[model samples]
Target: MQKFILTAMLLTALMLAGCNDNGTGPKKENQPGEILWVEVPDSIQIPPPGKFHKALVKASVQDPDGLSDVDSVYFYSRKPDGSLANKGLPL
Candidate 1:
């Protein structure tokens, strides 16, 4: 009777060990749960002659987990030389 109880307790311990949540399950990493473009302009007109121009850019962003998970949103102008004009500009 004592051996039977010991075996049952061991089995229960093993079963509970198998159900441990170690945060190593199959999870989607860096996935965008939702994407929204609030104000994506159709065209950006450059000023003629020597003049300065500024455009208004806006967006609505969210994540299923939380907003804290989002590190940053990147926005830059691609140059003709195939390089990022403004790198590490916060949005």
Candidate 2:
């Protein structure tokens, strides 16, 4: 039991020491009127199914430095209608 407890404590300490930074992750440089990433659900499940494309609009101007106004990350989804959807958390 003593050995088991020590092993567990050691494992926990190692895991905690290996902390992962969750700061915006990969850096994204702003661009003028540029669409960064676009994603689709393969197929919508509305009634039967439908084809839809979404643009992960980058709400910012050209700035290699970085962007601060991230209007949204997801643009376009079910129920939101033909309009573009935006679900970005601004920094």
Candidate 3:
């Protein structure tokens, strides 16, 4: 029983020490958030020649600081050639 207790304590100490960082890495403070989810139409009817249609876009984003920390979100469309349709448009 004494040997078992000592081994367990040693294992616990090593695990804790491994989890402690010595601050050698760069800090990630104020980092930008990530887009968690996005919603867009799967298909849309084509407009007549010389006409156009607009699709609604929605996105869910998260930030380490908070939602308020996020400044803006933009969306970019890709053409059939895999090129950006235009400069990103603000959402």
Candidate 2's displacement at residue 60, Å, is 16
- Give the residue spans of candidate 3 off by over 4 A: 1-28, 42-51, 87-91
Each prediction's whole-model lDDT (CA):
0.72, 0.52, 0.79
Checking candidate 1 for backbone clashes, the offending pairs are none
Best by lDDT: 3
Residues 30-77, candidate 1, lDDT per residue (tens digit)? 757466766755556778899956878787888977888887676666
Q: Where does the lowest 10-residue lDDT sum fall in candidate 3?
A: 82-91
Q: Stretches of candidate 2 above 4 Å error?
A: 21-33, 36-91
Query: Which should have the higher TM-score, number 2 or number 3?
Result: 3
TM-scores across all candidates? 0.41, 0.26, 0.53
Write down the lDDT that model 2 would get: 0.52
Query: Which scores higher on lDDT, 2 or 3?
Result: 3
How do the residues 1-91 of candidate 3 rate in per-residue lDDT, one tens digit apiece? 9999999999988987897575676776687799989999866677999998998888888898998887776676765677666554533
Q: List the residue pairs that clash in candidate 3.
A: none
Q: Best candidate, TM-score-wise?
A: 3
Q: Listing every candidate in turn, what is its Cα RMSD in Å to the true structure after a full C-alpha superposition?
A: 7.1, 14.4, 10.4
